[model samples]
Target: MQSDPAAMPAPAGPRENRAVLVDVALALVIGWILGAAAQVAHWSGQLAPGRRHGPGPTGNEAGHDWPRWAEGMGQPPPGVPWPALIAAVVILLAVALRRAYPRAAFAGALVGAIGYVAAGAPFPVTLIPLALCGYAVAGREPLLRWLPIGVLVLPLAVAGWWQEAAVGLTEPGPYGVLLITAAVLASATMLALLRRARRDAHDRERREELRQAALGERLRVAREVHDIVGHSLSVISLQAGVALRVLERRPDEAAAALRAIRGSSTSALTELRQTIAAFRDDPGRGPTAPPPGLDRVDELAAALRAAGREVTVERWPDPLGPLPASIELAAFRIVQESLTNVVRHTDRAGAAVLLRRTGDELLVEVADDGPPLAAEPTPGGGLHGMRERAEGAGGTFAARRGERGGWVVSARLPIGEAP
Candidate 1:
């Protein structure tokens, strides 16, 4: 089915439409008030005698006919020096329509200005409507679209000034019209540029926010993948080595080692699927299981032991109680990554895991009594990941060589309301 292009809905949202309506309405009301004031000045004779271009007498004793300037330029039709109320209505309508149809509104306003001048209208409130239309045009249309309008309006304005001056109404020159036109165009252009700059700043801010969100999400996925795959693979490697060593004599032990490897691999696969589902934004699926935390430190230590490391866990103050889930998860990952590093780099090194609460902070430390690995760690490796995880959870992490001659990793995590 064919659809008419003219029937398409505007891209502006409801909020933007309302804002435009309010602005246009305010401009209309302001123009009407100014026009009304000019009408009062005309009635009170505050303005010059011949300035009112109406059909009635100009109050001049000579009783001259219509001015020569009114010959070529069209005059308002009969009964056309509209009352203040009718003029106000026309001005209001023309100003209000400026936004959606800037060119048409501006042209209509210019015609109205000509009629108002020919009618000898008391005050030139029409200039307000024209200026507003120019502003709207400058804001929405490109320079090429409205630049010609500016160029054309200046000459017409100069002619109007010349007519006023020729009749002894004001000083004779194009300078007055030139000044007014320049002011109007400059004001409109400045406002339009400011609005454009503000919108550009807002757009840049919005794009930056989206980019940061995406980067954070990617970092989260990377952290999860590292913790799950790295830990499971480390366990599988140890079990596979045990199985190969025992296959000749201890058949049952070898079989047990193979079963452990199967369990670790299965667990790794399940977690990987969950991570993938999360990335795909699946509604029905959530995290497959709660994240490992401090409560699972013993299980983690046992796994490290199985990986051929001597591991000891010490908890200060007996019962550590419950902590925030984020803190617990960060602590667990720190210990897990530390253990993994020891297993991968050290040969049966002894490591200690410590958890303690002091003041408003929970401290977690992992240290291995082995020389640092000779291989240079890659950027954003296990240690860097652990530090990011801890700091991102509103904590502080530090890793340094222990006084006893081994690498030590420590994190001080806030428990509650601690800076």
Candidate 2:
């Protein structure tokens, strides 16, 4: 079975859905409690006394306790306990839903207000929920669409002036209109701010991802550097030692070690150039000329002799034939680096290098009879360099403690003509 290219994961919508649900449930519970409290208060008639004899208007509803302040007039008293309770509950539900789920919350507020009207709440009072719904809806929609919703309520506003749809309905005059208008404007502003906040969060996440990618690139560069330089210097050190020792006893042998050192140094310089080229981005920069092949092992051995390490090279004059550039470089570096390690780390008087070419491949071995040295850390800078050179050329690299306390570095590379 194959994987579908279109499959992907998304999370934001679900999280927002859950948040809205929790808010609505909380609003519902609170609205119920407030309504019940308002009913009990109204039942006591503690709001105002019965109509008694005389003055301007006895039992004037204007003297009763109003639930909310609007325009210039107070809304009618909540009336009897049950009616008052029901009205209180409606207002609570509207206010709660409007603020909580500003967009989706509008539905609940609208429903609650209509219920209050059915229960005989006054017109000016009923306007409370309508105003809240207006503000909330206006805030949730884009700027251009919000004003039309305000225009929708004009007919209902005009109807309040004539008579009580029930006993409590009344015109709230200029104050009511002004108050509701203010709420609509405020809601629109809040929505703009919420939109801005979301954009800022998205930008922050993008920057963090870029920072992590840069860090990874730097680490890869460091590893490649360690692989190239470490092994080359070790080989140079061993050859230098051989050259120095032979200088006193055999001028010819000393000269050999010096030659080997020079050869190895040249190889190191070439590898460094290739590494730098790998990192350059200019399209003009192409892969460099192929690296040295293993056929040059004799020259490598002579370099060690010049460095003062006793060196012996045994091989078919051209044991390793033509090989791929990558494989050739790998084999050369492996041999070069191993000899370098022997010169640098061993006090051995002499070292032996062997190259055996077989069908489609070549095996290289470097062993020394130098003074014993303790084991060092795995893939230390030098060994790591040798390993990379080998593996990169489609080969393997291994270095370990030898039987006589000396160390050996060996590599096997694929066969092909040298680049």
Q: What's the TM-score of each model vs. the native? A: 0.77, 0.41
Which parts of model 1 have CA positions greater than 4 angstroms off?
1-12, 23-59, 62-78, 81-94, 103-123, 159-173, 273-288, 372-380, 417-419
lDDT of 1 by residue, 16-92 (tens): 79978886777668666756654544443333223434345453322244433244545422332254445455556
Cα deviation of 403, candidate 2, in Å? 3.3
Report RMSD (Å) for each prediction in the order shown.
6.3, 16.3
Q: List residue ranges in candidate 2 displaced over 4 A.
A: 1-228, 231-267, 285-287, 314-317, 372-379, 387-397, 413-419
**Candidates' lDDT values, in order?**
0.71, 0.58
Compared with the true structure, what per-residue lDDT tens digits does model 2 show for residues 1-419? 88766785455487767755764665566555545444433432222112112234322243334332222444434545565456556556656666455544444444444444334333344444555555566545655655444443443333323233332234354235435535554564566547656766777888888888787566546655554566557666665666677798888877877777676678778877877777678798766765466667777676555554578877754544456776665666666667666655656556788887777677888888865656643677767767766776677878777789677778877776555
Each prediction's number of clashing residue pairs: 4, 41
Worst 10 residues of 2 by lDDT: 44-53
